[model samples]
Target chain A: MKNFWVTLGALVAVGLAVALACYRWHCDEPLHAAARQRDALAWLTAEYHLRPEQAAAIGRLHAAYALRCAEHCMAIGEARGAVAQAEREGRPASELAAARDRVAARERVCREAIELHLREVASQMSPEDGARYLGEFLPRVAAYRHEGAPTVRLNQ
Target chain B: MMNHTNDPFSEALADWRVNPPRDPSFRAGVWARVEALRREPWAAYVRRHALTSGLALLAVVAVGGWVGMRQAHARADRDRALLVQVYLSEIDSRLVATDGTP
Candidate 1:
């Protein structure tokens, strides 16, 4: 009886610890949002030379990229869930393999889509604007903006 | 060749040991510089830049804060990634130990 109680207490403690651990580790929302914000600023800075219409188009492209990322995550979830289900039911190996392959294909498609979007963003910009991108825009939109930190003076 | 050389090493040693300059102006110049430095506090000279110590300190603190924030973010990124990796690895290890990797 004592061993049973001890084991029960340990399990409860461990379960609570795990719950807290997951809560603490959950940085997905904030980190990903920060990345998206930087990406938006990058787009904004890169298209200063372009017409507003062109800039608006890039904004549309950003919205699409966000959607694609969500789709990619969903695909991974679907694949992982199917695999888990297959393991539970002792399902056939080929079926599991196919699910994994489908997820892999979706992942590739997402990467290609992003690359193509970058190409479009670049092609729409003037050469000078493009250079500004390489020289300044890429460095400034960081969380800390290291490369563009203005020089400091004592009086001002 | 003069074979009767009187200990050339000793002569060379004596030549090197000769006393330094007898004129006192050199020491006076050093004292003069010391007097000049004493007459002018560094704050006056440094004031040309119009930089107050407090302002300099604030600037340092501000830049330091920015740098610290950047470092913290980088460390947070690394630590976050490591946390995810460790969590995944723990799950993997438990599954492997339980023979549940199928």
Candidate 2:
């Protein structure tokens, strides 16, 4: 009976070790690799199978657009703030409408800029991939609410 | 010469006899009990053949773990793809800074 218990315990331990190993190597490995990547550029290069030159070109475009994007973000923030302030102060209907229009206009401009930037990035890829990239991204830009950075929901 | 018919004690001894009660299934009952005793209980069997039982259990565990690993790997591949998409979107939008800036 004692020997039986010992053997049962050992088997249980072996089962646990096997489970842990599977989780680490198979379940967690890919996410870990994704985490180890430097940024989106690396992800793009890998996913799209971009040539080195293509990746380099896209990288330059991204760097230049980043500054413009920040400026747009600030402008949009200010526009939203104006709308908020107007609402808080119980401003005239016309004043509130104007503030709201300003926010919408700023968001429109930001979306247009993003669309153009995406086009430029896509142009750096191969023809088929470029079209696919645009197809994937254009609708997202159009639908963006400017609430925060867009994210892909993994669970979905 | 001493065993003559006139001895009453000898006559009584000769008349003494016994008749047991009848049991038709007694033989069958006894054989059934014998079979039960011959069969080994499962726990004792396993204990007696510990090495073989352990090896069988290990094999089962190994196969189950392998299948689980395959499923996990497939799921991870999908998650990796989604993560790549998220990374690109987060960078391109710039509404929320990846660098923790406003």
Candidate with best TM-score:
2
lDDT of 2: 0.71
Alpha-carbon error at A145 in model 1, in Å?
23
User: What is the per-residue lDDT of model 1 for residues B2-102, given as tens digits with 9 covering 90 to 100?
Assistant: 55358888678767866676886888999998777556554553454345544654555555455555555564464433333322222111111212223
Candidate 2: segments with Cα more than 4 A from true spot: A24-38, A126-139, A145-156, B1-94, B97-102
Q: Supply every candidate's count of residue pairs whose N, Cα or C atoms clash at under 3 angstroms.
A: 0, 0
Q: What is the interface RMSD of each candidate, in Å?
A: 22.6, 6.1
- Give the per-residue lDDT digits (tens) of candidate 1, residues A1-156: 343344345445554555445444543444444333433333243335557777777667666666655655566566566667777888788987886676556545544554465556656678777565444322222222222212221112
TM-score of chain A of 2: 0.73
Residue A24 local lDDT, model 1: 48
Q: Would you list the C-alpha lDDT of every candidate in the order shown?
A: 0.49, 0.71
lDDT of 2 at B37: 45
TM-score of chain B of 1: 0.41
Deviation from truth (RMSD, Å), model 2: 12.8
Q: After superposition, how far is residue A41 of candidate 2 from its true place, in Å?
A: 2.4
Lowest lDDT 10-residue stretch of candidate 2 chain A: A146-155
Tens digits of per-residue lDDT, candidate 2, A1-156, equal: 454565677667777677667766666642545545535676677667799999999989988988887887778778777877888889999999998888778777877888898899998999999998888778766766332433425335
Give the per-residue Cα lDDT of candidate 1 at B79: 42
TM-score of chain B of each: 0.41, 0.42
